[model samples]
Target: MAREGVTMPATNQHNEQASATPNPFPEPALEYGENPARFLVEELSVDDGEGTSGELMLARIRGLETIELCGFWLAVERALANKESREPRERVERAIRERKAELEEHGEGLAQTEMTPADRRAVAAERDAESVAVLVDEGGEEVSWSRQSGAAVGASR
Candidate 1:
């Protein structure tokens, strides 16, 4: 089900490969027998508690291509810079700078990491075995994700 006020560009994975026109956001290369590529582009409508609204597009990409990932990060940085609020914009900018520094130092090892066919199979099996549930605090201001057990396993901000 699609969310209200958010639109996704229509794309067929199979057709994407054959098209002469390159996709603005293309999927990263995958290993043999690896799972299909999937990414998310979220447009958030933020209400300032007053009538005014601001919007931002956040992209979550998973791929092996470092250059394409950097390009996507640039897009996200540009979007965050254009946001109306100063707080979130500054926070995200700082985070991006910190992350870039960290990546610059350790990215060589990351670039070398690759998933084997067996590793992909194990990941798929693990995903299939796990059951996930979202839990909300009493005031509904905080949320967490729990596995099969009701106890909170990970918190989401």
Candidate 2:
């Protein structure tokens, strides 16, 4: 029986229709090995909104589809009784998570930006002066300093 205004609901397999037309979404490009999975964010229970049932306060949630307790699945009454005394714990956890993420993200960039001692010295020398002196042992192991400034042979003469 169908209502006048409301149409019939979809089938259990929503995508399967009688007609064999082209599917808008083909098979996924990447191969998913056996036992596929989904990514989900779990938010702790707050205010009056609770877990599976309104009465069951969620301690933690595992996955998107299969949401349950963080570690243990507690009965609604037990969970409500064992609720957090205060919400400061969540804030500390949030700060640690943010800092960890920032470090992980910037660690590589920091490594890349760092220069070796030799490289740093070369850069500093380039910035400091246009010429440098090369000390040579010319006179029977006697050290002699000579400035290398691209100076001309005429000046030497």
Candidate 3:
């Protein structure tokens, strides 16, 4: 069933390759898959809180690669956040600065009012997982992932 403000196309966004550690979120439209080649996920709608915006979706439009550009920029941001070393962090930050300039000049053309389906799901899952991890760690339990079930299990060190 589709939500009130979201519309997704029917696409198999799941990764077929089985790994030693499986992904906890396996729904195709819910998370980023292991395969980079599988790009098209689903269409989404965008709406303002005041009901003043139009619907926009992930589509291969003519002469418009805004979705791809947005995804690349997001990946760069993620890499910057995940990098711990100063050198790598500095490199990503530099790239981000350069991209920010370009975005400032052309952002209006590529502005998205709603999150992509995969991104929305990933964000929610990440937040939930982070909260759970923090709670577990606070309880003095070493949080570990189970390879067989792909669930986070509390263990004693």
lDDT per model vs. reference = 0.39, 0.29, 0.36
| Best candidate (score: lDDT) | 1
Off by over 4 Å in 3: 1-88, 106-157
**Count: clashes, candidate 3:** 0
The C-alpha local distance difference test score for the whole of candidate 2 amounts to 0.29
The residue pairs that clash in candidate 2, if any, are: none
Q: Which candidate ranks first by TM-score, i.e. highest?
A: 1
Clash pairs for candidate 3 = none
RMSD of 1: 16.2
How does model 1 score by TM-score?
0.26
How many backbone collisions does model 2 have? 0
* TM-score of predicted structure 3: 0.21
Residues 24-128, candidate 3: write the lDDT tens digits: 223422332232112212112345475322122113221133344445434533443444232323433344455555445554233445765456557767876
Looking at model 1, which ten-residue stretch has the lowest summed lDDT?
A: 31-40
